[model samples]
Target: MILLGYGFIQKIGSRDFFFKVIIYFALFSAVNHVYLVVNWAIDNPININRLRLYAGKGDVIELFGFIFIFCRKKLQINFRRKSYVKIAFVLLTISFLLYFSRTQAVAAIVIISSIYGYTKLNKKAIIVISSFVVLAGGFFWYLNKMEIPRSAEGLEGFLYKIKNAPKEMFSTDINVNNRAELWDKWRSYEAKLAIEQVLNDRSSTLVFGKGIGALVDLKDDFMLNGKLERKIPTIHNGYAFVFFKSGILGLSLYFFVVIILYLKAYSLKSANAISIATNNLLSGFGLYLMFTTLVVAGLYNTNSTVPLILGFILGVEHLNNLSVNEDSDNRN
Candidate 1:
């Protein structure tokens, strides 16, 4: 991880190189999912669930970060061409909401609002406030009027099958509405059991943890029956996973990395749009990781895209520091 961070920092002086890479990668992923959806439509019309460009709901949000950055950086900023941003936002928002996943939809709303607020701070704030009230009111009214469906018999078994299955297991998209239901089970049982075992353990086990992948020892009946039956169950919560596997020292190190990156981003002096956008993306992603670690895996082992993007953002901050140091030396 240290080596990788160093490598990314080395590339910070290059403007828009990493940002363009990220945007192009997301575009490729989006296109790939479109093809997947088409294939699924032909093969299994009845079970056309939302298409994921990548695994996990959090990944969907990351994709939105790419899209948000792309639209902002790629589109022309003039009034005549500003329509492009609006058009892109509308189309991307609608398509992702309907076919991608709810998480992406929510991310789209957030990033769009944020970027817009950056451009038209005072006006955007008022508009966003009014829009929020209107949307909230309408949503509540719809919920009040809608009829609730009763759970059918044997549904639990079906859910169990999906929940324990390797690909579908713990996937929020597979059973979006039942997330709380699944989380309750993980929290009340599996996690609880693991915590108790730790508390009862002797030695300095709490300082070093049971070692990586040790949490898989908490498997139960649901996991046993699944095709992706595990030798060790994944702790859905990243923070807990780190603490359980690596102990307090590990968790502290993890936070130390985040705090250092945040400080770099906060202190960066770049005025370029791409640099500014990278900072915004980092800030958004940092918050996303904080919340997501409670429900899904963190950037550690899940995927490379997140760490890669974050690395480049940090690299930009490094570039800023370099410029600052150079200016001071020249003055001296």
Candidate 2:
């Protein structure tokens, strides 16, 4: 479906195709998160715990980051430059608060700040560093000070858990006290454990993998509680899924493609303002997806959003090349 969607979008051949998809995704994701936030705020009929929005958390955050870049780079709705930046900044901040997605938020922040810093480096780096410092300070303050409704008490209850996430990462405990665990136990820690389990006896599997359904077979061995008879059909971590399914060779190829794309996107040089901005945003999106894949299980998941993202990047890159070549020909 993702591939088909990508093909269809590319077939459309509209320069604004990527922009339209990203903007729509961003808007829908933002609205969904806002709805959850309001429910969390009001303790309403639909609470945060019970609410599960259709969009993946990874997609939501990536969309938010993509939209932020769009706002800064492509938006020309009669808004001043400052107004565009402010709008993007506000949307990002709101999404972080309401969605409570740490990995995505971290990725978005790092990418945005890096782009800002890179763009300002020749002029002055202090402005970029200071901007980041202020944003971080304000965000932490909000996280600590935000009042939680009684119905959504888990939000406040996890403050200490979040604070201890780094230290608790190595711990073996998967119980309540260990709630601060990164990737929610299954994706991060258990995924590592599963890898160890697979490689313990059959080290050769590292080369060729156990063959396609191998991860599914090993799930019960590593994840079963003895209380449950069912197995998790999918591995939570995308890298782990690939490694278990196709071994180290597959994983290497995957990263190889990603590295090529990142290099290609960043290496694009353009004096045209729109071209530069689009290139920067595309590069940032690439960065954001790199982190998202760790926890997203997107490699083999049928519902992966990464393909669509790659499609847009490739499309935009193609368009950029055409424009650059046209300029060169005209100059000649």
Q: Pick the candidate with the highest TM-score.
A: 2
Against the hidden true structure, what lDDT does model 2 obtain? 0.57
The models' CA-based lDDT, in order, is 0.51, 0.57
List RMSD in Å for every model shown. Answer: 7.4, 5.9
Query: What TM-score should be assigned to candidate 1?
Result: 0.64
lDDT string for model 2 (163-276, tens) is 433333334555534433432454555566557755874778888776776535433433243445334556656777777777889888878865664454357444565566
Q: How far off is residue 308 in model 1, in Å?
A: 2.2
Model 1 spans > 4 angstroms off: 5-13, 42-65, 68-95, 98-189, 224-230, 260-277, 324-332
* Backbone clash pairs in model 1 (N, Cα, C under 3 Å; residues 3+ apart or in different chains), count: 2
CA deviation > 4 Å runs, candidate 2 = 1-6, 36-62, 74-96, 114-155, 167-184, 216-230, 269-271, 298-302
Clashing pairs in 2: none
lDDT of 1: 0.51
- State TM-scores per candidate: 0.64, 0.70
Worst window of 10 by summed lDDT in candidate 1: 48-57
